[model samples]
Target chain A: MNPSMAITEAPGLFTANGLTGLIFLVMMAVTLIGGLIACTAERLVRSVAGLIVCFIGVAALYYFLNSPFVALMQILIYVGAVCITIAFAIMLAAPEENKKNGPAGPLSGPLAFITAGIVTIGLIVMAMRAKFTSLPKVNGGSVKEIGIQFLTSYSMVFELISIVLLIAIIGALVIARAGRSK
Target chain B: MSFLTLYNNLNTFLYLAAILFGMGVYGIVTHRTLIGMLISSELILAAASINFMAFNRFTAPDPTVGQVFTLFIMAIAAAEAAIGLSIIIAVYRNYKSVDTEDLVELNG
Candidate 1:
């Protein structure tokens, strides 16, 4: 994110590097705790809250990754649009009074925990073992560069995604409206 | 090398994404309600995006490409969430319940 390549000197506790490290740790904790709550909570509303928390942590992580634009999008599209829509759906469809069914068997409980554990372990091991070759960046991935590329080489895909989004909106309206007459 | 500096390593982000993806998989399989599954699916998508951004930050020859692709992914995910939630709303209207077990009328 900075014009400087890397920090040469060791960071003291309250210096910029040290403070950044602290923030990174906090974001990691937020992400993990939020993820745990999102998956494990029994209430849908609580789970959605957890999702929002998790997305915020992720957006912060994006900022750390040096892409503020994506971070902003993460907040805008996800926390703003998607989660709110889901919350509204919850209000309209599944209310608090409904008899909350527990997760179905065979896939729920200990089996699901084991499955998830195994998968997580496998992936973590793979990540730990793999060697990443860092290639030099050709250009700084700035927001303006992102915009120019979007309008140029990626224009076709961008237009296609927009069209898909349009269709999805119309289709959602029709589908949600169809059952109203009954 | 240090725990505080974990953010600088590519492996750290990779591990984070993997854990999130695993959580999503567990959620999709175990959640009894349609909305829970949809939420889990979003988690999966987020994990994928993180992986892309990590690779973009660390290794890509052209850094802008990953960010560009991630933007498109966000658009697609927004569309999917919109359509999926509407379908859930319609399904709830039809059945009066959104539980996965209650949607077995057409299973024959």
Candidate 2:
């Protein structure tokens, strides 16, 4: 049964749709590899590097999702700002995980893997089974439309997030500054 | 649905998000350090955003809503990262280690 969504017939390898699919597969692979490295890397620095690669792949995925502005912001905020801040924290905290010399806990490695696998399988099954109703597009969801909605419909939420971010910055500075004299 | 056109399907994005979420959960459970947990949390957040965007692209009546929501999530993630990293720094300063096991004491 064909859903309402676009499901093109198989295109030849040199066709535009085929090329786009190929690129998407590459991006998907990049994202998974980076996430694997980030999760399993021995060093924090290498993990951060992997996180960077993962964010870039996610940004590309966002572009494929038809929100180029969101994709660009994803790159700017996540890859550029957030990852850089994380790198700086790594330098400052400098925790090398030297203690215990053994596994993190009795139920950490294998148990964690099993738990994650179960959770993933459950989510995938649920998603596959659920039938989502598609509504006709009201607007193009362009950057302009997003801006208008932000200033109009979502103005309160926007302001609240701004305040929350300000508070977080101040709180972070205060927390980091404490016990510095000791 | 052919593999070549998987990008146009909602299920593909959902599956990708699920896998990423699982990886995040695994990272959080297995990681011993605070920063490492923070990194994994970001992955989880990304997974959530992907779900939002995928739905926005395929099912939403007003598509801008999900995009707007994703933008808010990014802001929140940024703030969380800032606060979390700062707390980690403070914890390190007090205990000389950022490992979860080393942070047993509540005192400064």
Candidate 3:
């Protein structure tokens, strides 16, 4: 008898597998709901809040994918830094109450929906038709391995990204401060 | 391959990423304000990250590569947001409004 056959069957509710699945479903729901609010909310501040919820769900998804370090980083960066930055921008610039943020043209709504629908359906179909053969993992991809790779294999890239971030920060400050009055 | 174990499947993640990407596209097309567009762009970036992490988990031989790539993506996204918001702020200062329709000097 083959040992892997048992995993093919569905686990009952209350079991560990079922509980994990339930949690996964909850995370998915949370992500989708947050995305919906982010896209559809009337107020820009509300959209930022929804984006926070969405990023948290995404971090949880990263956890389920076995990258807890990346998950934590997601929370630390996206929610902590990025969302706060966006919120500040919204406060500084967004005039949500006065101007209506509706679709530009009459056909824009239906056309956008169709375009997005086609894109999503096309990607899903492509993924379904394509056969993916998984290769054996060479390493566990743990935090330590990631650290070593950053130092050894991908050192140039890591250095480049830091430089990129530094330039972005300086550039942003220059651009935003251009029109400011003393 | 039961529904309960969908989390272990690659297609599930693929589908989720696809849907997220579609929503981002829709948001980009529909949202009229610059800040709204920036928010939607974040969704697109998140979708791309999910795709990377999924392939990394289910297919890649060296899983750390995807995580590293995702980290880079995060860095890029942060930089993008910073630059983009500053640009938005500048536009607002010049035009006194963030609405796309208002900034129509180059429209031919």
Candidate 4:
């Protein structure tokens, strides 16, 4: 019944399960490292790369959370679409030659870091202290169930989102195109 | 609390989300460029989604709700990104710069 023992008894250090776990760990590392780079890198392009890495990590995390559908969507949307779009923006708008000067005010950079650190610590402490009672599962959150819930319970919101997306697309095209003539 | 069961703990995900949120805040506050700020905003939204999914996995009665909600959030985020980037492009064309410091034409 002990799967860990069975896993360890396999010849190589990388059994199927162990290899999966290792890959997960590596992905986690990539995610965190990417986030750090995205937040701290001086260059915008490097930050975009970090964002891609972090997103891939998030997708992996989604898979670990038992939502492969969302995970794939995350990769497709965030990495495939968003990051590439951002890269194009970086190229078009952001000047590559300008070195990042320190923040505007004298205390801006340090103050921002301190503020972020404090907020992170406070939230982590609160989360750790809170009492969370586990609830019984009504139904397994399968892909079929997700589809049914999307249509039934969240149909209004789903429809609204489609409309919002449509508006966004038209608005983006309008705004971006408005400048080309001038 | 145990190291071996880190993935099973709700708090781990919460702390991760918290970190992501804080990083997003820092980026938003400090980034000079509009596009960078938008990217940071996306990070904040992703952090919120993580928190939702964590609660969904650990405590929600109907877990599909959270997943669906997260999906909606993703959709909104995608649209937001598209719009935001286009706005950035438009602004760059008008002002010739994306730096927040230089966007002072409305100072009057």
* Collision count for each candidate, in order: 0, 0, 0, 0
Query: If the candidates were sorted by their lDDT against the true structure, best first, what order would they fall in?
Result: 2, 3, 1, 4
Q: Model 1, residue A152: what's the lDDT? A: 97
lDDT tens per residue, model 1, A1-182? 21223555556668777888789989988987888778878889988999999999999999988899999999999999999999999899897786463568754677888898899899988877777777788999999999999999999998999899999999999999985975
True contacts kept of each: 0.70, 0.75, 0.72, 0.55
Poorly placed runs, candidate 4 (over 4 Å): A1-24, A99-102
TM-score of each: 0.95, 0.95, 0.96, 0.90
lDDT by candidate, in order shown: 0.87, 0.89, 0.89, 0.81
Candidate 3 structure quality by residue, lDDT tens digits, A23-126 = 88899888888887887777788888998998899998998788999999999999999999999988888765696666778999899889999999999999
The sequence of per-residue lDDT tens digits that candidate 2 reaches over residues B14-39 is: 99999999999998888888898899
The CAPRI-style docking tier of model 4 reads medium
Clashing pairs in model 2, backbone N/Cα/C closer than 3 A: none
Candidate 1 wrong stretches, greater than 4 Å: A1-10
Better of 3 and 4 by lDDT: 3
Worst 10 residues of 3 chain A by lDDT: A1-10
Q: What is the DockQ of each candidate?
A: 0.63, 0.71, 0.65, 0.50
- The weakest ten consecutive residues by lDDT in model 3 chain B span B1-10
lDDT of 2 by residue, A94-129 (tens): 746563322387867899899999999999999989
